[model samples]
Target: MNLFTDIRALVIDSLTALQSEGALPEGLDFANVTVEPPRDAAHGDMATNAAMVLAKPAKMKPRDIAEALAAKLLQDLRIEVAEVAGPGFLNMRLAPDLWRGVVGAALEKGRDFGRSSMGQGRKVNVEFVSANPTGPLHVGHTRGAVFGDALAALLDFAGHDVTREYYINDGGAQVDVLARSVFERYREACGLTPDIAEGLYPGNYLVPVGQALKDKVGDSLLDKGEQFWLEEVREFATEKMMDMIRADLASLGVEMDVFFSEKSLYGSGRIEAALEELDAKGLIYEGVLPPPKGKPDEDWEPREQTLFKSTDHGDDVDRPVKKSDGGWTYFAPDIAYHYDKVQRGFDELIDVFGADHGGYVKRMKAAVSALSDGKVPLDIKLCQLVRLFRDGQPFKMSKRAGNFVTLREVVDLVGPDVTRFVMLTRKNDAPLDFDFAKVLEQSKDNPVFYVQYASARIHSVLRKARDAGIAVDDATLKAADLSLLAHEAEMAVVKKLAEWPRLVEIAARTNEPHRVAFYLYELAGEFHALWNRGNDLPELRFLQEGDSSATQAKIALIRSVSIVISAGLGILGVTPAEEMR
Candidate 1:
C-alpha cells in the first residue's frame, strides 16, 4: 500500500532483470536506490535515483543507464509513464488506477489506515510525566504527559509494543517537604492557626490531604515533633497526592501502564545491583572529581566520591553515583530505574524529560548504553516551555497553583482537544505559544479547526448522500468505480493520501508524534484545495446531480481522506469533528 516502497521494489526488480539480461554488470550494489516524492510535485509523482546510484558501479553513463531503466520501468502497468530526468534521475507518473487503489486501501483499513509494521513488534518503554509526587501536575507536566502518551500511541500504531510509564519521585527529600506542608494543613483542620512558613507548599489543593490526615490518625499525631511524625505523614500524604495526580491524568485521557516510584529504588538493593553490574565491567570507581569548568559552585571542592565512568560512553566527565555523605545522588536511583527497565528486556527506551533537565540527557543515555552493553538504544526527548496567552496578553497565573499554571486551567479554557492539538503544533524541542484566542479561532490559521473542518465536511457529504438514498458506507464507497477520480486536482489529493503510511514510519522511527499532526494538516490542506477547485470544475465535485455513480467515485476519494485523518487524529489523542460548532 506504500506507493514509494512499491515503486522502489519495481525499480529493484527491473535492475535485477537488467543484470540478468547482461545489460549491466554481474554485481552492483543498489542499496542507495530510493523512491520518494520529488522536491516539487511538478517533477512527477515519484523520482528514483537507481540509475544514478548504479552508474559508477556498473561502468555506465548516467543518461545511458536512465534511458534503459526508463524503458524497462515503462513496461510495467503500474507506471503510466517513466521519463529520465536530470542526470539519470528516473521520474515516474503512476496510472490514476494506482491512486484509486490507495483510496481503496485506506477505506479498507479505516482507523488502521496508516498503521505500519516497521518496528516488527520490538518492545519499547516510553517513560513520561514522571512528575515528582509532590503536588498535582502543572502545565509543564501536561505537555510532557500529552507528548509521551501521543508518542507511545504513535509507536504502537507503527507496530512497536510501547508501554506508557511514569516514574514517581517519592524517594527524595521532596516527599518530606510534602509531609511538612500537609502537616500544617492538618493542624489547621484541627482548629489551630497553622504555620504557613516559607518553603512549604502554599497551594490549597493539599488542604484536603491535611484534613484527611486528621480523620485517619485522630489525635495520635496531634502536636507531634518532626521525628515522631515525618515518616508516617510522608507515606500518608504521598498516597493522597498520587491519587490526585492519577485523577488529573485521567481527566486529560492519559493512562500509565506503570507508575514507578523513586523510593522503591532506595534500600531495595536495586541501586547497588545496577551499580554492581556496571562495576563488574570496571565502569564504576571512587574518585575525587575535578571541579567543573568556568564559575564552579562557590561551595565546590575536590572530594573523593563514588562515581560512574560515564565518560567511557559519551559523557563529558565521570558522574557521581554517591554523594560525599555516602548516600546515593539523585542520578543513582535514575540509573537503577533504567537498569531495571533494561533487565526487564525493553528493546528500546525513551524518556520524556522537561527542558530544564537538558543537562541530564547525556548521562542518562550513557547509563542505558552501559547497562544494555549497546544491545538496546535510548532516546530522551525534552519538551520545551509552553507559554500560555489570552486576550492578546500572557495568561494569568493560577490561584491554586500560585505562580505556576496548573494543567487543569489550560484544559478548562481551551479544552482538552484544542490543548492537545495546539501542544503538538510545534516540535517538542521548540518553545510553543498556546494562545487561547487563536486556538479557539475557527479559521484556517487554527490547525485543530482546519483538520476538524475537513472531517466535518466529509461527514456533511456522507449525510447528504445518505439522505438522498445513496449508500455511502465504506464498503460501498470502496467498491465505487474510482476510475472517475482521474482528474489531476483529485489525484493530487490522492498523492497526499499515499504519503500517510510513509509519514507514519518516519514519525515513529524519529519518536515524534508532532509529525503526525503536521502531516494531517497537509492532508487537510490538500483536501481543502481540491474542494475549492471543485467550485470551478463541476466534474470534480463530490456530488454530481445527474449521476449517482460518478458522485460516489469522488466521494469515495475524499471519504478515504477522511478515514486517514481520523486515524491520525486518534493517534494524537484528538477527536475528529463530525460537525463544526
Candidate 2:
C-alpha cells in the first residue's frame, strides 16, 4: 500500500525490461534510483532520478535513457504521464485511480495504515530520563521523557521489539546527599533545630519524606550519626524519591518497561565482570593519561591509573576506569550497565541524555563498542534545554522543586496531552521555548490545537452524516464510489496519505519522533485547506445534499484523515481529541 515503493518497483522492473530488450546495457546498478514528490508540484506528481543516476554507468546520454525509461513506464496502467525534464529527471503523474486506491487502503487499514515493518523485529533498548533520584523531575527531564517515550512508540510502530528503560542513578554520591537532606527534615519533624547544610538538597518536597521516615521508625534515628543511619536512610529515601518520580511520569503518560538500579552493578560482580571482558581483549591497561588539551598546567596532573583504551574504539582519549584512591571511577559502572545490556542480546541500544552530556557521548559509545566488540550499535540522542515563559515573561521557579519547575507543574498547567505534544514541537537537539499563553491559545499557530481540531472536525462530519442516515462507518466508506473523488483538492489529500508509510520508516530510521508531529501538522494543514475550500465550492463539500454517493465519497476522504491523525498522535503518546472544547 506504499504507493512510492510500488512505483519505484515498477521503474526498476521496466529498467530490467529495457536491459532484456537490448535497449540498455546489462548489469546496471539501480540502487541509487529514487522516486519522490517533485520539488515543485507544478513539475509533476512524482519525480525520479533513474535515468540521471544510470547515464554514466550505462555509457549513454541521460536524455536517451530517460526517453527510453519514460516509454517503458507509460505502458503500466498506474502511470498516466511520464515526462522527461531538465538534464535527465523523469517526472510522472500517477493515474487518478491509483490515488483513489490510497483512500480505500487507509479506510481498510484504519490506525494501522502507516505501520511499517522496516525494523524487522530487531530488539532495541531505549534508555531515557535516567535522572538522579535526589528530587522530582525538572523541565529538562520532561523533554527527554517525552522524546524517549515517543521514540520508543515510533520504533514499536516500525516493527521493533522496544524496551523502555530508566537507569536509576542510586549508586552515586548524589543519593548520599539526598539521605542527609532527608535526615535534616527528619530532625525537623522530631522537634529539633535542623542544620540545612549548603551542599544538601533544599527542596520543600523532602518535608514529606522526613515526616514519613519519622512515622516509620519513630524517633530511634533522631540522635544517630551518619554511620548508623546513612545506609538505612539512603535506601529508604531513594525509594521515596523514585516513587515520586514514578507518579510524576504516570501523570504525563510515560511508563518504563524496566527500572534498572545502578546500585545492583556494585557488590554483584557485574562491574568486575564487564571490565574482565575488556581486559581479556587487551583493552584494559595501567597507564598515565597525557595532560588534557586546553588545560592549564596548574590544573593538570599525571598519575598512573587503571584505564580503558577507549581511543582504540573511537574515543578522543583513553579513559580511566579506577581512581588514584583505588575505587571505581564514575565511568566504570556505566560500562558495566551497557555491557549487561549487550549481554542481554539486544540488537541495538539507544540512550537519551541531556544536552550537557554532549562530552559523555563519545566515551559511552566507546565503552559499548569495546564491550560488545562492535556487534551492537549505540545511538545517543541529546535533548537541549527548555526555557519556560509565561505571557512573554520568564516563568518563576517551583518552590516544591527547590529552584526549577517540576514536570508535574508543567503537566498541571496544560494537562498531559498539550504538554506532550508541545514538548515535541521542536527538534531534540534544538532549544525549545514552552510558552504557557501561546500554547494554550486556540489558533493555527498552535500545532497541538491545529492537529486536534482536524480530528475533531472529522468526527463532527461523521456524526452529521450518521444523523442524516448516510452510512459512514469504515466498512461502508471502503465501498464508496471513490472515483467521484476526482477533484484535484481531494487528490492532494490522497497524495499526502500515500506518504505516510514512507515517512514512518524515515522517522524511525533517523530516530526522530518529532518528524511525526511535523507530519501530522502538515496533514492537518492539507485537510483544513480542503475543508475551507468547501465553503466557496459547493461540489467540494463532504456532505452533499441529496447526493448520497457524492457525500459518501467525500466523507470517506476525511475519515481517512482522522485515521492517520489518531495513529500519529498515538505514537506521540497524546490522546486525540474526539471533540475539542
Candidate 3:
C-alpha cells in the first residue's frame, strides 16, 4: 500500500466531511492538495498542502483551516502527531507500528512490493535503440538501449501496457553507403584488392558480411555495376546488419517487440496517407522557410516546398515535409511513422533519440499533436554521449568499429550489468563517463556494486540465521513480531522501504528511469548504515545471541530490504547478486 496515497485519501475524506457539515464551501476544488514526504525528515513523516491550497477558496484563514484539518487527522490512529508547520502546511508523524508494518508488507509482497498501477493499463509505445542499420551499435546507442529498456520495464511495473520497438533506418542513403561498403568487402572476399574509400564505412566488422555474401551468391553478382547490384546488395546488407544489431542487443538483454523499417513507409501508400491526413486538416501548405537559424541567408535562396504548419502547434517555424525536388524529406517518413503509431491506438508514444537529434524534437511533437488531433501525447527523450575511460585515461576506440567503442566491446569488457548501471547513473540528457577502473571497484563509490552488495549482505544474514537453527523463510519472517523492530537505526531503513511504491510512481510519472537507479542507491545506503550500526550496538544486531524472537524481527526488516532492492534492480534489467565474491 502507498502510505502517501493513503494519507492523501484520508485528508480528502476529511475535507469532504467538512464541506458536508457546512464548515467549508461546497464547491471548492481540492485537486491541488498533495501529500508528500517532509523536506526535512526531522519535521515529520509526511506533509500536506491542503490548508494552503484551500484557504482562499474556502474564504477562511490559512491557520483556521489547518487547525481544523489537524483536528480531523489526529482522530486517526495511524497519525500520531498532526501539527501545523509553516503558514498552513500540515506535517503528520505516523505511529512507529505503521512504519514496522511496511517491512511486513514488503516481505509479503516480495519483488512486487513497489509495483504501482499509476498508468492504469494505458497503452504506451516506447521506441528506442533505433540506431541506423549501418554497423554494430556503438557506446552512444548502448545508453539509449539501457535507458529505453529500463524505462519500458519501469512503465510496466507502474501498470502501463508497454511495447519496446526499434526503427530501422534502412530507407535512407546511409544504407546505400553501407551497400557500397559491403561490396568492397565482397571484392576482397573474391581475392581482389578492395578499395577502402574515405566516405564509405571502414569498420572491419563487415568482413564477415562480405564472406557471407560470397557464400550466398558465389560471385554471381561480382564485376556488376551499381544499377545491377545496388538494390539487391542494399537489401542483403541491411538484413545482415540488423541480424548483427539484434545479436548486440541480445548480449545486453534487450529485445524489441517491433522492428519497423523506414523502407516500408516508402513505395507504399503510407507516407501519402499520412501527408494526406495533414493536408485535409489544412496543416499542409507550400512555402519557403526562412534561412536556418545560424546559417547565412546570402547563400540561401527561396524555393517552394511542401511544408507542415508546425508553428501552429508549438514549433519555432513550419517544417518541410517534401523537398523542392518533390522528393520526401527525412521528416516525412518520421511523421508517417508516428501517424502509424497513433492509428495503431497507442495512448502515448515515446521515442528515445540520441542527443544530436534534439533539433527534431519540437517539429516531431507538433506533427504528432496535429495527427492525433491532440488525443495522444508524445515524449521525446534524448540520450547524450558517453565517454569511456580505462586506467585513468581515455579508452581506445574499437578495433572492429575503428572509430567508436561498440556495445559488445563494452559489455565484453565489464559485463552488461555494469555497463547498464553505470550508463544510467547519470540523467539521460547528461553526458556520462564510464570509468572502467572505478565501476568495477569493490568500494561503495560504485553504485552498482554498492546496491548489489546490499542484496548480498541480506543473503549472508539469512544464511547465518539459518545456520543458527533459526527459521528465515519469507513466510516465517513475514509473520514475525515486527513490533520488536523499534531501534532508531532499524526504523530508518523501514521508512525508506515505505517510500518504494511512492518513488515508483514519481519516477514513472516523470518518465525518468534514472530516478529508480538513484533511489536504489539511496536505499542501499540506508540499509548499509543500519548494518554498520549493528557492529557497535549488540541490541541492533540482526541475530541475537540467545533470543530467537528478537532475531526474527530484525531478519524480517532486512529481508524486506532485499525484496525492494531486487524489485528495483529488476526494473533496471540488472540481476541482484546473491553472493559477491
Candidate 2 residue 401 C-alpha distance from true site, Å: 0.8
Model 1: lDDT of residue 358: 95
Please estimate how well model 1 matches the true structure, expressed as its whole-model Cα lDDT.
0.90
RMSD score of candidate 3 (Å): 1.0
What lDDT score belongs to each candidate, Candidate 1 first? 0.90, 0.95, 0.93
lDDT of 1 by residue, 504-549 (tens): 9989989889999999999999999999998898877888997998
Most accurate candidate by lDDT:
2
**Model 2 ranges off by over 4 Å:** none
Which residue segments of model 1 deviate by more than 4 Å?
none
TM-score of each: 0.97, 0.98, 0.99
Clashes of 2: 0
| Candidate 2 residue lDDT tens string, 1-581 | 78899999999999999999999999999999999999999998889999999999999999999999999999999999999998999999999999889899999989999898899999999999999999999999999999999999999999999999999999999999999999999999998987888999999999999999999999999777789999999999999999999999999999999999999999999999999999999999999999867846896778999999999999999999998889999999999999999999999999999999999999999999989889999999999999999999999999888999999999999999999999999999999999999999999999999999999999999999989999999999999999999878888898888888999988999999999999999999999999999989999999999999999999999999999999999999999898988
